[model samples]
Target chain A: MSALLDSVLATAVPLDRALLLAAVLFSIGLAGVTSRRNVLIMLLSVEIMLNAANLALVTFSKVHGDPTGQVFVFFAMTVAAAEVAVGLAIVIAVYRLRRTTDVGEVAALHEIDYGPVRYPQLEGQPVHHHGSSGNGDGDGDAGETGGQPAVASEEAHG
Target chain B: MTEVLFYCFAAVAIASAVIAISRKNAVASALWLVLMFFALAGTYVLLEAWFVAVIQILVYAGAIMVLFLFVIMLVDLKSEELAVMGAPRFRALGLLTSALFLAVAVFVVLNTRETFVAAADTWDRGGALEVESGSAAGIGHYLFHRWVLAFEVTSVLLLSGMLGAVILTKRRLT
Candidate 1:
């Protein structure tokens, strides 16, 4: 009976344990975001990450002599809610257009046909990696400033 | 005693969170996330932040979760159409990268380890109520007095976010 009760209860958790829990939750969320192609999953993963942050903040506030960390958690929650609202709106817009939510297929903004990507030894074709930040159906004008496959800024050591 | 509750909550929250995010169905994922939020709220209570614990339940588990479910319903996505999870080769790379990140994060947490040895004579220990800095009322004072400007800004942000969502998706519901 004593052993059973002992199993049920535990000693006081150290500060590190809280931090450790936060880290675990954060990492799990991070991995979920990376692995999940669904935009909704990514957004949910973001929520998990935000919750981890809140956990850490509250823990720190208790350890120290302050309520600032808890206050910060409220701010975080507000931001998170706002972000989800906006993100879900965007996701809906995208889904309506393409009828799919796959991030890979939603590559309308990808750098199309620069050159043989990844293998830079066949021929050191000048890589025109001029990065474009524009997002619209009409991104061709921006690509006009695009360089060749490989921009030889420096002399290629033949 | 507190340690036991903390560990149990933490373990269950993490496990459920994993289940939540890994589920293929978005609705299932949201449900799992609700479990996580509840467990997290329990941890907050254990930490003696009763107000935060209440808000955690009310805001995160209650309001936020309902919003997520609503959005999920609106999206009404099919599993087949939801296929943007990258390729097998790239998926492996992402997994490896996230694993590395997880390892580094754990290492940092361990390195910065600090135990939460609660000192005597605070309101938490059935002590005097003279020093109530970490209480909910204290947090409210800090927010309205010290961080009032930021607080107002957050309200504005929330309003704008609501307006933006309405503007973005206000079409014929087919």
Candidate 2:
């Protein structure tokens, strides 16, 4: 066993070991993302995946003795930082609208519970809601905010 | 010596990464991830890329982690309260699937030969001359001379990210 250890360390470390580490990190991230129901944790898993890629980039950069790999890593980090900014912003926005960030719950899907019976118009039509031009721009804001527009319009009329 | 250092750092990185992902508390998880990042930076040093190693610690451990902590605090550290009943079984399945993928990935990685071993020879061609390729000065030279356009684009990307975060978090548009 000691002989094997000595032999392994005798040469420059094979790139294989570094690559294997990256694979393990990536799998861990994949598992975390799949199992976690929380949006925040899922984002954390994505960050893990990004870091794993960075590890591989640096490993390869070391192999070629080229600065290009490091440059690629720089670009990747830039993109990752941007992604986190935008993604967290969206998550926060979603959480504001619905108090929870659970993926399984039907917070945003509440409208689907209403079904076709409420609308009843043009279920038989192939286009689905495209023919509802008569509803006009007035209903557009109402549809977006649920009930907020009705109050604003009523205040305007008053 | 480098190889020994490589194994030690790799072990630390993987172990901490496992702990990071498995933790239920976001703060604990973030702390573990910070350790993982440090170990990975150590590995970068083992590769003799001093500039990359420093940047790994500075950008990832310092800047990106602060961003993660900011978002975690903003979210109030809430985990989903989805029912516990079938959750364990689902989580176990996720573990099994990822383990299978890890096995396949490791197998493929080991079987494939390194793409360009010629660079190792290049390192031997001229002793002092070859040293420049992996150094800070070398990277900066190429980054400005060869890849200036991409560098400029990276700045624009960060600028847009700042605008996006501020705009999205704004409470009142009026």
Candidate 3:
């Protein structure tokens, strides 16, 4: 047995290869999380990202011939489990309240509105295209009507 | 022999990961993730960490991923259109970042002169890592001896997580 390949065979592969693979996985996870919306899928993407890091850690541990990385992996898994538990609970609550788990709709809540932002009750209330009339007088006219005109227009759509 | 297995499994792992991320259906994505985990376990085997490979299969592929599947089954997510494709800027940014990272990783790997193989030769006979018939013995010794405290802490954390999860889902009395 050739010493280099034989030794590598024993460990399974070169450290460089393992590291590169882990990095690729990590980037895939990163892209998934960045682009995907559905909160559940986002959380899953995060899990994948964490796994990618764990792969790197374990690969390094094997390369160094140490058990420390395994120990760290155990801790990381524990933390990941905890994160999922909390995260899923939040997603469930959000889904229950929102009806539709669409992130685009949720962004509307960030607007400075003067009423209770009851999202659960607002899911199918009709599309509120307040400023989409291509008019620069939105803020000026909105002050006179206290945004009632927007609600009226939406009710007309409904 | 090992190098071939390593490359094969690595390719499988990467391809499956990409499939997992790109699949529009959540369940299909989870299935791809399972394949990716299995391929990763194969890579671990090639690395000679037999026990780690088993744990990778049992814990990650078997247990953790099962939980992910369960959660995916439980949730009812609306099928969102793959709209990020509509944004050219985001796609451009993603490609740029991935390419940059790949370039840096390759540069680092090529620049490193001495590798783990040289160290392994000297460290094999007498070192912190005790080679055994199988990794089970070595891992068992280290886990119980060197990592006893951390193990116990993990147990506590898991317990707390279970309780916390139950509490989060429980109906509150008015």
Candidate 4:
């Protein structure tokens, strides 16, 4: 076993191999973020991307024989932790308000007015459809009224 | 032997990452992500970044994943809802875009491999020899000395993040 280990250690792994792995993982994570609809899964994908970056950083650190890259990895991990905490909190809050984690249905802030603006939180109820009358006052009032009920309902649900 | 182990870990990491992203179930995805993290940690070990490898397992595989599992359980998504995806065309477009990105990145790495390796070799030869560069002691010295200010700032970032999370998730402002 010792002899085998020594022989293995004799030939160091190339840096690009690890870098290629990082690239592959990062692309996979990107695909996840784009393809998956679940907000939680999207967040997981972001974590995977961060992990891939960490792998690349560690690999370079090994190659250059510097600890600075490792220190950067430390900071990256701290930021990742903080990001996860805030992100999950937001997820919980969104789940509570919308009763669903589907990213498609949680578009309350989408202002494009794409055909009768379906608010998932206000489902199973009459949505006051104030037609965009091409007047600023009417549109503003409609927007205010549209937002107020969602908040009121959220409070009631909570 | 090390190269073989590295390849094994890399293959595992890539496979698990692909599985983790493609899985419909969030819990299964999170579990697979943990496996990927473990594989990544193994690769880090092979690179002799022992401290980083340990932290990779502890923080990523352990803490962050538990937090993910908690959210997954708390969300309690139904099966019908889990079927949600964007239009098939958009899905295909997204996958195609990422595949293109992967191809470009791999191409760049392959082309620059010799230059990068030669530069790194020169730096290793010319720089002051630090035998414990990947060890915890060496990392700690850098972290607490040269990177101390950033370390303090990171603590501040974490504190703010915790406070923000608390405020965001609280039942009522009052």
Best by lDDT: 4
Q: Model 4, B34-129: lDDT tens per residue? A: 999999888887776778889999999899999999989998988667767767987898899889999998999999899657755665465432
User: lDDT per residue, candidate 3, B51-75, as tens digits?
Assistant: 7678777877777777777766666
lDDT of 1 by residue, A5-103 (tens): 434422334667787788889888887888888888889999999999999998877677578888898899899888888888888776666666677
Q: Judge candidate 1 at residue A91 and give its lDDT.
A: 83
What are the per-residue Cα lDDT tens digits for candidate 2 across A1-158? 75664454345655767888889999989898878777766777788888888878877776666678887877887898899888888777666656556666534655443332222122234432332334455444344322344455445544
| Backbone clashes in model 2, listed as residue pairs | none
TM-score top scorer: 4
Mark the 10 consecutive residues where model 4 chain B has the least summed lDDT: B122-131
On residues B1-95, what C-alpha lDDT tens digit does candidate 2 reach at each position?
76678889888888887787777777777888889889988877666556777888898789888888887777774443522212788888988
Candidate 1 regions with alpha-carbon error over 4 angstroms: A1-12, A110-158, B82-84, B114-134, B172-174
Order by TM-score, highest first: 4, 1, 2, 3
Per-residue lDDT tens digits for candidate 1, residues B1-174, read 777788899989999999987787889899999999999988876665667888888988888889889888887888765544657787777778777877887788676653344332243464322245546787898899889999999999999999888867655321
Off by over 4 Å in 4: A1-8, A110-158, B119-129
Looking at model 3 chain A, which ten-residue stretch has the lowest summed lDDT? A117-126
Best by DockQ: 4
Q: Between which residue pairs do clashes occur in model 4?
A: A8-B1
DockQ score of each predicted structure, in the order shown: 0.24, 0.24, 0.18, 0.33
Clashes of each: 12, 0, 4, 1
The TM-score of the first chain in every model comes to 0.61, 0.60, 0.61, 0.64
lDDT of residue A117 for candidate 3? 38
Winner on DockQ (1 vs 4): 4
Off by over 4 Å in 2: A1-11, A106-158, B78-93, B114-129
